[model samples]
Target: MPPQVVEAMQRPMVPHRGPEFSEFYIALIERLKRLHRTEAEVLLWPGSGSAGWEIAAVNLLEPGDVVVAGVTGDFGDRFALVASTFGADVRRVELEWGNAIVPERLDAALRAAPGAKAVLLTHNETSTAVTNPLAELTAVAQEHGALVLVDAVSSAGGIPIEFDAWDVDYLFSGSQKAWMCPPGVAIVVAGRRAWERTRETGTHRFFWDMDRNLEMTKKGWTPTTPPISLLYALDAATAMIEEEGLEAVFDRHRRLGDMTRAGLGQLGLRLLADDAYASNTVTAFFPPDGVEARTIIDRMASEFGITLAGGQAHLASSLIRIGHMGWVDDEDIESCLTALNDVLESV
Candidate 1:
């Protein structure tokens, strides 16, 4: 976390229902709107990004509603599972773990399940380190008359996402990723179409009710007691993003991604994600033949004090992920790569 964000969180708490809190909450929402590039109602929930998926599913889907989910990685599969748990007939467009979902494949799935209520997408799959073609995929889903629900948990503030331009029905992200804040808050943006669907869905909801949340939002408050400290951190982090400029922040991530990928390649390691659709926030790659992913991760941490994430599920033994998103710079990537190279050499 940034120094300002830490300082903001350390400040004394205020009354959640008071006028001072309302003003602060309203101002933060406005900044979040600018960040998302949307005029839709942006809600901050006291939950993780995964909770946003369930909130969206229950509010927008009726039991037995058909959903076309693109299963490109662990997170994508989890979103599909959430929708199915809420009673949606999730028809997954399954892909290999390291591959991205192409528009043609998604279009075929939507056509196969005609009249599907919605399409679930992960904007950037951290588990696979692939950024799906969101705009093109959204167009395809909309053409099939399906609403687009996106999980931008790992890509929201780092990568370029124009929610209004894409006409996304619903999109949600976390405060911990590219927002440069501690975890706790789930940021959700609901478009006009999604709000209309929420009114018609037969699914039951209370704490996650969008309608009730919308009412409280009008009064500049949350339905439940808010996470005030996390909110303070978010406010400070968002200000830093604005001061540095969103485009500049995105450019830095892109440069770091390029540097990391090139360094890994020069070290004789193979990248898991295709170069055509690599993620700017995280990069996944395989260790050299004879070296285990665990060996590299453990050595990098114990020897260099640089923590790296291992792959998820089936890819756990073979894949490793390097995050280069919020609060990271060129030198950070360089140091990580140097340590990784040393680890590989010794192994």
Candidate 2:
């Protein structure tokens, strides 16, 4: 259950090519910088995180450039596949689907792929509800002097990701997840090293071009017209995060995650992710013996008005996923848990 954020729905739209929009755009970028904990440039594009994946590819990598990718879940696999389609050599460090990427394995891959120009990782693997050891993996990347590009779609605002401290050269997130806003914007934040790499990148990307955004961004605008109302809503929503303080925002997620996991324990459910690798945004649970995940999810929704997220890929019907991202809290969690308990009892 998402918290009541009625203000976002009521925000007035403005002209995307006008002065009013420019002021909002510039301020929103600075505000996003605080959210990202970086001094790097933040680019806003007219696509989902899917587009951010390719933007990262075209902006910093030309054909034949090599990168080491971490494959822990579905999105991680897709990111590597996207980079490969762009003509980059994709070397992967594969891990069990429900587990986080062990830094040692990545270190080995880096050692093996010395020509690797970048390392791609998902900060939170939504498909598995596991938070990768980004701080550890990026540290290894820095040791090898390789740029780090991160997909933080599911974990952006809910989980802590310090772009500067982690030395992640490229980071991108979508608005729909933790932002609790409508989808249409792909936010990409790039560090100085990643920005410089763009100069040597010869790939052609017109609309998803980060360089054009970088230029327009300096003047309080964008390369193309943006979703002005969604920008207005993002301004309203993410600003609320700042008012609550980032630390408290993260704690809210942790508290809810802890409580949700505890509730799952009382229900005799199994968390798909290992405890140490579990995420604060979402929790994936393997269905108990003889329980149908799809049936339970259907019952929880159709019967109880509780809408929980579902798993991806092979785990789709094998696990029940509860999204505790964005503005979820104790009461909302209690409601979901109660619905879950009711549905489980009948199971």
Tens-digit lDDT track of model 1 for 1-347: 78999999998999999999999999999999999999999999999888888988889998899999999999999999999988899999999987999999998898899889999999999999999999999999889989999999999999999999999999999999999999999999999999999989977799899999989988999999999999999999999999999999999999988999999899988999989999999999998888889999999999999989999999988889999989999999999998987888788
Off by over 4 Å in 2: 1-6
Provide the clashing-pair count of each candidate structure. 0, 0
Off by over 4 Å in 1: none
lDDT tens readout by residue for model 2, 1-347: 13334465566777777898789889999999999999888989888877878998888887898899999999999999999999999998888888998888999999999978999999999999899989999999989988999999998988998988888899999988898888878999999999889998888888878888889998888888787767776787888899889999999999988998999999999898889988999999977799888888889889888887678888877888999999788998999988888888888
lDDT winner among the candidates? 1
The residue pairs that clash in candidate 2, if any, are none
The prediction achieving the highest TM-score against the true structure is 1
Number of clashes in model 2?
A: 0
Candidate 1 whole-model C-alpha lDDT, 0 to 1:
0.93
Candidates in order, TM-scores: namely: 0.99, 0.97
Lowest summed lDDT window (length 10), candidate 2:
1-10
| Deviation in Å, model 1, residue 91 alpha carbon | 0.4
lDDT of each candidate versus the true structure: 0.93, 0.88
lDDT of 2 at 14: 74
